[model samples]
Target: MLRNIVEEHFDNDPDVTIAAAKQIRRMDRDYADVGDKLYALQIAKGNRLLDEDDLDGSWGQFDEAGALKPDAPEAPNGKRQVLLAKGWKEMERCYHACPDLAIDALEQIMQIDANFREARSKLYALYVSKADRLGRACDRDGAFPHLMRALEIYPEGGEAQQGLAVCTPTPIPTPPPAAPVQVPTVTPRVVLPTPPPPPPNSPTDISAAPNSPTDPPVVRANASSAAHPAEKSARTGCARAEQSARTGCPVTEDSWRTKLITLAA
Candidate 1:
């Protein structure tokens, strides 16, 4: 009966509500067990503080209720109404990109009533939004805490599930094996120079005729008496005389010749 009076005047008359609370405590043999009534008195005081815009004092009372009965619903002292209104206001903050204030209000609403589904849903959505934005920015590790919080609220939510997947540690791609170190093996190629065409009417070195196919063709000469090569006699007798004299050929003494051939006609 005393409790009913407290509820009716909880927000309207602080004096009357406090008096009613005292009366109820006196009437009950085990008043200490009436935690709900005590909680109501605290909420009434908090509402009075809130009415005066004394947010700090009101917070103390509300927090006390949370410490005592965290799962309790808001009291009849306009506490429920204030929390609901404040929650929406904070949501507006969120829209304006003030996430910190928005999150604080949503959490407060939950402290007032743990079963507030709208607050939970919105809070979960906000957390997921932050996580996704951060993940897209290559902050996957930083994004995980937000997704984890969202999951704690709604374990079955698809958004958080996908966000968790986004935060999952992915295997770094193995770099394409460093392009095999190219050693650039240099093969030593022996280049043989092409032998100059036999001098205009001169015979090629006959000694070179029986050599290997791959060998360079050769020419033999004698130092000329003139600035130019001296022509040799084609006489077979000259060769015989050279053989008798121990020279290899009429033009010889076993010598080879080459020219840039600036003299080519």
Candidate 2:
């Protein structure tokens, strides 16, 4: 009966402990009371050994040889043994920090020896509380991994599961798009009206006008009249005026008036 209780305590190996629990629960509830009492005594001793070892006080069971078996080793210590010591320290802190969680682990360990489990359950709970507190204080992703390993070591470990659930990450949210830019329009330049030309009989001369188109015709007439008086005597002066500007002297329109004044002087 004592052996059966040990098996249930290590329910981490579900298949084996489940089988053992099934068979043991069916036996006479009060039958082998002495064996039940002996199992309780053994668990107390085992819990003391764990306390001496400073192990995370989780529930465990014994093997066929009546020797207690614990879960797997925690993560390896770093080169300087820095990371490993940190993990151990954190687990210890967790066990001490949260009384409720520590109690849960200790109670589960003591389940096999109800009397022993109850007597030392508080201390066992402290161990678990220390481990959980350390994990949370570190605030690292590795904390979850350590907790997961504890669960794997003791598949029935409720405290480890709770730690894992809390340390899990949450998802991020997305945002919306921005507004468009506005541009200004520009206008073109405005042109002023051109003044009208002077009348043919006006005292105001047309040549002084800036960029006037009528200057070339007046200059051509003056040049032809001055150079071809004989052509005018024969009534052929109009044709000679056109030819004079083109061939006679190669004189420019500006020089025409000057040359005529010189001839008169």
Candidate 3:
């Protein structure tokens, strides 16, 4: 009954196991192993709690087991397992929401056991993830340390190498001076010759006077003298007028009247 209680009730009813062990020890000397059985029960309960991810409960069980038998290796080993499980749980829960907390938790796990279940890899991945997130947010300065730490963890990590490359500053090259602009030459304009003025007293230069008694006589050109005797007489009158104008002499009225009457006849 005591063996059954220790084996079955240790996980579900720890108080029942304790009561059974106490009663069995008082009743028979053959059951002198009750104290050792109780120690085993506590260690078993702690391991079960650890497997169920009940960190606080597992820690309490491991502490009670160690108090029961301080020289036992199982209790100390169980306590270490519980701490490792706690660190893993914290890291998983806060990796994205609170990366610093997650890093601290993983680091604690490293202190507990550097070889604990891929803790180094998990820590490296966390740093890389944090660096990537900050880089995406344009916080390169904030991301630098995390990227550097990730590279330290894994010197040959491709993602860490790429991230560091992105963070480094590159110098800009200076541009060459621009070529001078060319100005086009203009052509001179050609000058044309001016035409000569028409000659004075040309046949087209004739002008007529107004028909008035006080007005001077008008001379008209003869198209042809052979056209008629009248035309020949008219030409003679025009010749006499031109002769009077050249000498700057006034013609006698009687002479002009006689010449005009003859041309008219």
Candidate 4:
């Protein structure tokens, strides 16, 4: 009846089954299989708690199961299932509110099971999202590490590739010079010839000579004889007339009168 009670409480009440098994072990020293029965009951209780999402309670039950039978595979497997469930729950709760914590949770899941329920994809997306936010806030230096990590997670991710390109730095360039100016030349002047002066005055120029006060007043003899020629002729005729009268060789009175008239003429 006690063994049947232990078997009946194994699924529904593991604690009752544990108490019944302990009482059976105490009553009959031949009941050596109670230890194995106790281990099974504890593993059953841990699976029940894991299904209820009671990670702490499940961990305690599995720990006790492991202590009962250290070489048991059931306890370790149950603990692993609990850790996976806990990590997934934490990541879902804090992914938007606290992304860093969510990222840590996903990374832990990766260590346990790399392909655990989109963990690698979620981690890659988180890194890319952090990098994008930092880049938009003008913190490219801070964004580089996250972008690099994202690329490491997903080498072929277009978003991560584009982000890395945006975060990288480049160089600048220079300019050219200007040209020169021009000037003109000047010309020379010309010269002319000079003319000659006039000649000097001669001694024949009467206007150049002045009169002397002591010069004698000269008279012309031809001018004086020409002016009295008729008077001298009349005087000569009178002398001839008087000499004829004195001579009186054949002096007729008529001849004497004729001679006088001729002298007068």
Tens digit of per-residue lDDT, candidate 3, span 198-254: 677544533442457976766666668447888777876787789799978767668
Candidate 4's residue-wise lDDT over 144-257, tens digit each? 999888888789899998988888855454555555555566576665656554346645665545555765444447754776878876766776677767885654567768
lDDT string for model 2 (1-265, tens) is 6356545555345444434543553564444443343343434433443455534321332221132122312211111122222334443455656555544544444443434323343443354455676776876465665565566546676887778777775656666666666667768779889999876866584465555574454434566567766766555445446658778765444566677799999
Q: Give the range of the ten consecutive residues with the poorest summed lDDT in model 2.
A: 72-81
Error of 4 at 73 (Å): 2.3
lDDT scores in order: 0.71, 0.48, 0.83, 0.84
Tens digits of per-residue lDDT for model 1, 1-265: 7767777887788668767765776687366544566677777688778877766677767776655576766643355655665676667767547776787778787778757658888888888888988998999899999999999988989999988876785789988867778789899999999987777755477664576788775555645533333344345346657665785444433322122233352
Model 3, global lDDT:
0.83
The regions of model 3 sitting more than 4 angstroms off are 1-15, 22-31, 136-141, 168-265
Clashes of each: 0, 21, 0, 0
The most accurate candidate by lDDT is: 4
C-alpha RMSD in Å of predicted model 2 compared with the true structure: 19.4
C-alpha root-mean-square deviation, each candidate? 20.1, 19.4, 16.7, 26.0
C-alpha positional error of residue 166 in candidate 2 after TM-score superposition, expressed in Å: 2.4
Candidate 2, residue 255: CA error in Å? 28
- Global fold similarity of model 3 (TM-score): 0.51
Name the better of 2 and 3 by lDDT.
Answer: 3
The best candidate by TM-score is: 4
Using lDDT as the measure, name the better of candidate 3 and candidate 4.
4
